[model samples]
Target: MNLIRLVLCVCAVFGTQLAQADATRYPLTIQSCNRDVTFNEAPKHAVSHDINMTHMMLALGLKPHMTGYSGISGWKAVTPQMKVILDGLPELASKYPSVETLLNANVDFFFAGWDYGMRVGGDLTPQTLTPLGINVYELTESCAFVMKRPPASMEDTYNDLRNLGKIFDVQDRANALIAHMQQEISEVQKTLPASKPRVFLYDSGEDRAMTSGRLGIPHALIEAAGGNDILSDIDASWTRINWETVVERNPEVIVIVDYSEVTAEQKQHFLETHPALQSVDAIRHKRFIVIPYVQATPGIDNVLAIQTLAKGFHPQ
Candidate 1:
């Protein structure tokens, strides 16, 4: 009987130790766009790429864990709250890092999308780095094959943040962040107009206009802000469309997507001077609302984009 009791006591101790190890090391597995990735312990040396992933890390207060990052255009694109966090970190590259650069950084983990680093058949692809003891995670919205859904929603933001929280063992912070975002979104929703405005999203183009379509996040943001996207019927995310369509639809408000190279003013000038667009009511009245190109996509900045658009639509 004493021997049996001893075995029970040993089992209890072992179980307790196992639980403690889990709490500390955090053995976790997450299914990404194409594969299942497992982490025996949180990454000590990690690198993030692009504004979307970098902003998420900052929001979670995980700066200490990140050793390096890349792909941010400028301080102008970054929110002030995030800029303070980014100012203290090491920048690996102004754009996407080369495979050699990433390897030399001794990085154990990478946070980037397919376009950012894991492009098909590229040297920095997840498939290439996985064998080298490096783990790569693609941004949720950037996953196109077998994982993406048409018309992105804010829920994608919540789920992505929650996943990151799980990986870093900071689920509480993620939950709080999500709750705050929801509250901000709710406040914007309250100020929405009774009638949804017809919004034309002009990205940039002279010969053929490039614009957001049904699969893009801008379509979802416009709907959330109580505006109807004239090109929401197009199935692709970003596509080139004829100016005749713009002239026919005649959007009430022109939403100019501001980027680093192409300023919002340039796009506005193009629309204002376009021979075909002169008859459009938005052009006639010069009703223009500008949003940073980064904010129009899937990211934490989307709520702010919604709020800005709401005010533009309902200008009280």
Candidate 2:
């Protein structure tokens, strides 16, 4: 008789929780790359621990709710306003915050750019977070790599914003952002033709010269803007290429990616100083394009970067 009563009590408790779930209404239902999340209303507290993820959240107008961020150590590319937010938060050791600092913030949600399931010794996962009542939303774009899926394009980027719009319950805002980016890209694309400009992206430095390949937004932007990304012919979004191969290609346009302390002027000086580049087309005609480290990578700023390159490439 006691066992029967206990079973009945357990069922009553489970039923109440189900009833509560049914009674609650979530305004947003979003399927991110890693998980499906339902926001009861609008998220009032958010922390973007991923660099790319931070851009997406900012694009969604979640800046007001941001509790913390990672990778803001003297951000070379963050706007003055973003810098204010950076100053308020503790400096992140890497892309994500240390477990202790994150828990101390006592946030309701944690938005990450990449899945650190195994990277962090299996500590930062939704499964682990469930106990704390915290949820994780991994950027859909960033998850493409692990899913063995193809990288996204401007179109896919719009789609991502659309998904985020749904999650944030900001459909109108998302559309406007996408439309603005589209128009800007169209303007830049119109400036370039299919003549196929040979562009070499000098993305990294002596430590390790990083180049964007097929998987990253850099190559996507190059393809969309009608510039032939020399590294695209190779595979991978970002990779290391030999200087010997670079000297051999002798591209017509040299896009010096400002991914380090080296300024644009320094890159130009390097080109001029190189014995092999004395007669290069980019150096001769000043076809060299300098891109900020942030703008050179993915995010909304890419359109502006394309516009800059368009102006330099056409000069009309």
Candidate 3:
């Protein structure tokens, strides 16, 4: 009789724990782009896309919830910051996965951006997935025209981290992370040069010079780093300009965006060998600085990019 009573008591305790755990007390609803997203409970299985989006998940301590992820192979290499948090998460694809693959993964949530999962009528968009009861969140900067957006700034990065934290019930971690980033940015901004140098961001293109413009985070990064984006006059995030136009502007320093396909050395060589750039100040003086392609984008690394450019541009 004592053994039977002991078993019944144990079962009662176990049942109570299960019932409490099953209660979804916080039903979260937030406006994301064109859609109203509601999360009845935190997602147990998730899929993330692109470096920045994946980094956000890991930074928020959501790695255990991420059943699978995609787009890690595209980076030149996994950054040290990403390496520690990644912790052997399964990679679903080197790039974006197909709608069928996403469906098969049985992910309850998707953390991706416009180009990552929603490519102009491509499958696996929030429009298609939300109907199936999957929650989706877009990287704020990538939501540029999908919704009315403020100008790209470090605030966008903070908002993303904060939103993800709220969704996953980790608001404290998000606030702490944002505070650290803000402090770092403030320190770097204090050391800026009195005069901003004219900088040309070399992203990759032999035929035409493709560079960053006023619309994207790179433009803000240039401004923060004590340099002026010579192509800032352009309204779009990134655009193409001719070699003659480059000569006309005559940037004082060249900031080469490093990626896997085109080495910074190759771009430096192209600038040095081109006849049109013979008299260009940056090329002639060989004042070239290389930044990782990921750092040039909006993410946790943007602060580091700012500090790097400050040293390169002001090198006094």
Clashes of each: 0, 1, 0
The residue pairs in collision within model 2 are: 213-237
What lDDT does the true structure give each of the candidates? 0.76, 0.62, 0.76
1-316: candidate 3 lDDT, tens digit per residue: 1222323433444444322222234788866766778888888888988876776676666788888888777655466655655658877877778776777888889888775456546677787888877788887777764655555778878888878877887665566666666777899888776898899888889899878667677888888888888877776655677889889999999988887667889888998999889999998899999988767777777877888989999999
The positional error of residue 59 in candidate 3, measured at the CA in angstroms, is 1.6
lDDT of 1 by residue, 194-274 (tens): 898789998888998988787667887888899988988776666789999999999999998887677888889989999
lDDT, residue 89, candidate 1: 87
Query: What residue runs in model 3 are displaced by over 4 Å at the alpha carbon?
Result: 1-25, 79-84, 145-148
> Could you list the CA RMSD of all candidates, in the order they appear?
10.6, 13.0, 10.3
Q: Per-residue lDDT for 100-164 in model 2, tens only?
A: 66677776677664432213336666567656766666554455545554754666567666666
Worst 10 residues of 1 by lDDT: 1-10
